[model samples]
Target: MKTSNGRKLSHAALSLTVLGALLGAAPDSHALGTQGACQDNHIPVALAPGLPADQEVFARLCLPPGQTPATVQLLIHGITYSHLHWDFPDPTGHTQRYSYVSAALDAGFATLAMDRIGSGKSSHPPGATVSIDSNAYVVHQVVQALRAGQVAGPSGAVGFQKVVLVGHSYGSFTSWYEASDYRDVDGVILSGVSHTIQLTSPLRVLVPLYPAALDPAFFGQGYDLTYMTTQPGTRYGAFYAPGQADPAVVALDERTKGTVTDTEFSPFAVILARPLDIRVPVLLVNGAEDRIFCGPTLSGTVCSSAEALIAAEKPRLGAQVPCVEAFVLPGAGHDLNTILDAQQWFAVAQSWMTRRIGAGADQTPGCGP
Candidate 1:
């Protein structure tokens, strides 16, 4: 009887040792910021009215645990950014720090972070073929796919009851166009942007944008002069807030920065003149110290605060938008998600999302007459 008991104990010990070994070899699920509780899928979507021949846009779709989320955020990155802009990698190896994806998931919302047609893994058509109008059409198709369950992820065809279009900088411009023309999204969140470019002229000096072909990093990408990027050591000043962003994070920004097409620039010049016809709830958020839009460069203007900036923009948006809310993060810069108060920005966005898009139990208070 003693020998049998000894044998059984030995067998159990061996099984435990093997299990530990297997667990050690497994990839860290927490690296994805959800402790392996969520789903991440790489989605390939074809764009219509694209740069001819149907260009393909790649995106990363992240879904929270349990049942599908009621609202999905389609995140559009700004100039010189990709899907990574939404899910920034923490240089300190802390998965819980400074990730918009983690914040959205915690707030019970799914995220679809897409690379623009001329950036990241998406098909890079000729620079001239990629414009604000073309990108707006691309965004419209993506929204349609989300509503119709046409976007197939690893978890199978995924659809959402409500789709919110979120954008930063140039992406905000495109989102504005999408909501204005298609009026398909349930809500729109425009970050790192303002209606005016009065103080942004210095950007030409700060960002010495040269042809991507001239840069050694993009040797064989077939880039023309129209595809441009900032010179090295320029992004830190142009995007990050003074003494707010981590050096390592700034380095990552330089390494992963993408291209901006010439055609994308022309649209910005005319945006202030064009009237926006959006009928959905619109939220505009920017950094308090955003040098690009709200700086001292404007000769005959004063935008010392968020209220002043929003008031300046009210006329360009027309009187059609249902509810237009604005917030300015203190001490943040153009890249609000990478600065010291990044989590604060995320929390504000999620709170606003819950209030406006039905992500939480609370219903949206109507825009009263």
Candidate 2:
């Protein structure tokens, strides 16, 4: 009896060792693959060589434990933020978190977000012009690096021939630029974008407050820029939010002070010129209350940013871009795309990205009940 028991124990140990080896070799990570845990994924790696002191790169890994895919969507965060905007954070060498990634994971897709050059933990390499094109190049370089080299981060798997490029706000500028410039991008999601404008606005300085309040015609005079020193989130969401931004993103407006913005990057221009000869469809989501991108002018008339942009881009796609779906949910404010209108947004993504990427249509969801 003792001899038999010893032999059984030995076999168990051997089995455990083999399992460990397999886990190590597997391309997916258990840390990030938390089934339905509200966790944000993270990877700290250098995006490029010789980054500046203020910048560093972080790769967000959003893959479930048992499953793995060679290709996944690369999520680009908004301006002044890091990839951490996707999930809840864990203390283990991770910062910044977002809930959107978890939703995507539930949909059976993985996401990887990189810290842009001058933001967060990314190494902001000096001597590099921080324009929309350069930002696009940064993402392009990250994609190439991921493909060229075998980077087995938490996701375990590496090398995506192409990825779904997703961007919001300023990130959309770079994302559209990339989607147009690169062939590997299978699709793109431009959230809160539609029209190109001469946006070097001195008025963007006020946030967590109403820009209309600043326009002399509406509120009657020049308010101090300092009024936006807090409640930036509120300011942004007021015009952009479908709901109230409480404690409201009070970063106090004015994030980009003197950052050399490239006025040349025009969404309308890109669409009209059909610059990238793009073949992939674009999913545009605008918050019903978002005024920054698509809002009513003081003239009391609604100016449709998404409408104007799609109008310009439709001809270029001409059976190639496939479909353009715009969803304006009721009672939902801008920035609500990730929160309030979650269901519709998810459906739009799944349908187009998974089933109807090549089918052209003017399917605009949530324009009503």
Candidate 3:
């Protein structure tokens, strides 16, 4: 089966079954061990200046065991993903191998994984109503709620002394927008994204997208044809580096892939152009073979290594951010969290958070070999 863009669509039905299987598995037993509680919450927040009316954002707060954590990590997923991306369930039941939430829990940090307004279980408004600025406002409100202890958890109202915003891909862009304007977060960790789009055109060619309404999976949920989604079987090609991601993980991704609003893509340049005026520590993590951001497709540029990729983005962040660090995960692609060595990236992020934001476990040099 081929779409209008000529991309083949195979194994979509099989992928959907794979998704069901993964979702059917019980939540990780380690998600809330003796150390802390993981509470699912729906937070109502008003949209930002240029967006639509208020909506409820769905989030799961993972509290540290025993004592209240002074700092919390607020997680945001990118295009075509939800909170599930943060704590991906391994079909094989390997807790330590497949989950970033597990890694963070082991490191003794609280995590609040959220689904953006238009994605996941969060309220699905019109596609035009979601943008980077508006999503940033939603995140800012969530941060305020965390600080004020206004968000109601299962145990009770929950709050944190410090908050760090962690985002992947489009989520990273939203994080940059939040830290730039609100400056409320203690630290920011951006994964699966960068300032450059060297091969964006090629990526567009490869991942041919169609209307969400056209997809049989999401036809009648109030999403119009304007909401775009990648054709079946394209995710692995676009997101996973060659021979890097596990076959099972890739199958799960195809099954659970979400949608991207046209509004979100149109205003992306405006969002990316804005300078991040964050005064807190910032970390940028990208896959070494990321096709969109750091691949060898830029007409006149060379970004063949992780250091070169990070160097391209450093100057764009501006000098206001106090400390900035970058790590490129070897043999990974755009979806760093789902790759085989995702735990290693999580360790690196935890280390950075501990050193900069005073959250998580003691610092360990987890980036390099």
* lDDT (0 to 1) per candidate: 0.71, 0.46, 0.72
- Cand. 2 Cα-lDDT: 0.46
The TM-score values for the models, in the order shown, are 0.84, 0.61, 0.85
Q: Model 1, residue 313: displacement in angstroms?
A: 2.4
Please provide, for model 3 over 1-369, each residue's C-alpha lDDT reduced to its tens digit, 9 standing for 90 to 100. Answer: 000111111234323434456775423322322234567677877777554445888887776656666788899998888888887755544344655766777787888888998897788877787888778999998999899997655467767878889999889989988988988877889887776776463445335787878887687888876688888888877777553777777776777778888888776668767877877777888877677666453543223554675567767777866666878777776778877788778999988877676753343212222
Kindly report the root-mean-square deviation of model 2 from the true structure over all alpha carbons: 13.6
- lDDT by residue for model 2 (120-193), tens: 44544442344566677667766665565343444233555446777766677677677667655667777655
- Superposed by TM-score, candidate 3 places the C-alpha of residue 337 at a distance from the truth, in angstroms, of 0.8
Which 10 consecutive positions of candidate 3 have the poorest summed lDDT? 1-10
Off by over 4 Å in 2: 1-56, 88-98, 155-157, 196-202, 205-242, 246-276, 295-309, 312-320, 337-340, 357-369
Give the per-residue Cα lDDT of candidate 3 at 338: 79
lDDT rank order: 3, 1, 2
